[model samples]
Target: MHSTMERWSGRVAVVTGASAGIGAAIAHELVKKGLKVVGLARRVEKVEELSSSLKSEKGKMYAVKCDVTKESHVTLAFKWVKENLGGVDILVNNAGVAIDSSLIDGSTEDLKKMLDLNILALSVCTKEALKSMKERGVDDGHIININSVAGHIPPQDYFCMYAATKHAITILTEGLRRELVARDSNIRVTSISPGLVKTDLPPKVVLQVSPYLNPEDIAGSVVYVLDTPPHVQIHELTILPVRQRL
Candidate 1:
């Protein structure tokens, strides 16, 4: 089992929204594979508990309190990662929120909140990660952006703002990939767009929706992307439960 983790023995990874659900699972998976992981989330206590439960010789875990929407918090967190565990080699931009309401009925503030956290924070974190990677001379770094099927095919009713934010993330991921490639950078940018995953969203939403993908299933896709060789870049991967319609 340990030998299987050799590929990631010396790598450093950072996962945002990592206190619970998919973010936490991704951090656990990476640490199991021998990558030192820094879990960033607003729920510091939860992330601390998560970090304490990991078991790996070559890999370690750290918990940082971060509200991704805040630029100063992100900056401080990244700086801490650099000072403590070395520079980041992989960054998982997974912090997000869901605000469901019809376009006309939605509060402007709510819409802005979704956009700020989902789209703006992702950009901030990516920029910071890229800067650190470049400065550290990590020629082959990976950035995994967790998007949603909502990004590609939006629902007919409700979730207008949430879906729009996701769409923006999709576009950003693609554009960043192009930019990195044009610059001849070895860094890889990938977007993992998943259908409704089983998470702690309001029960009403899940009850209305048919089948949802498991969080681990999405995490598996992330691990797969990271495990791929440097020569191959998986630009976009959309995953849905078999029973999902669109």
Candidate 2:
């Protein structure tokens, strides 16, 4: 099970929501693997701190302040990448939120927030990445969506809308794959779904599942999918903790 990661050294990757949690972890791992990483987060300072800490690593990490919900910001961020570092070869749509609300009586604002960031933002980023790849003739580019088990099945009453947004990701991932195949493109799309992880996204009152996954665990999954043979496409990869019922 050797990784062809050596081929990616010095290539560019853009990771969204990289200030903390899974995004930050993935950025760290990619940097260690010698890929130039651009970490996009509203809290750009945190990513800067991470960049400083990883200065001695094999690769490098660049921080950009980006609010994924804003389409203009996303557009300019990719533009900056093109001017500064050529273009992006990999994109990780990891910025997402889950508000504790119900569909039956949920605040419309909360639902919209989830929809905008989780679904619309991911789509926008994917479009930008695919455009960059196409312009640069990067047929081997990859797009990874950091999805969840909730997207597969609503685990709790409060997470119904968030789950709905995730389900949209599942569909979007396959849809992109099909589109790429139709074009005879080597670009790959994958959805990495995790059951439970100790992250700040979940509310404090939410039950803490024991033996839960770590942000690094999901990061490892990202590396796994990216390391596969160029001909092998991993359409969906679901990761869960041991004894995780939901």
Instruction: Give the winner by lDDT.
Output: 2
**TM-scores for all candidates?**
0.94, 0.97
Residue-by-residue lDDT tens digits, candidate 1, 1-246: 112335667688999999988998898888777788999999989888888888544477889999999999999999999999778889999999987766887788888888899999999999999999989888788899999888888565688788888899889998998898798899999999998778775356674767877778887898888777767788899998888876
**In candidate 1, residue 163 scores what lDDT?**
83
The prediction achieving the highest TM-score against the true structure is: 2
Query: Where in model 2 is the C-alpha error above 4 Å?
Result: 205-209
State how far residue 215 of model 2 sits from its true place (Å). Answer: 0.2
Compared with the true structure, what per-residue lDDT tens digits does model 2 show for residues 7-73? 8899999999999999999999999999999999999999999999999999999999999999999
Q: lDDT values of the candidates? A: 0.86, 0.93
Worst 10 residues of 2 by lDDT: 202-211
User: Model 1 TM-score?
Assistant: 0.94
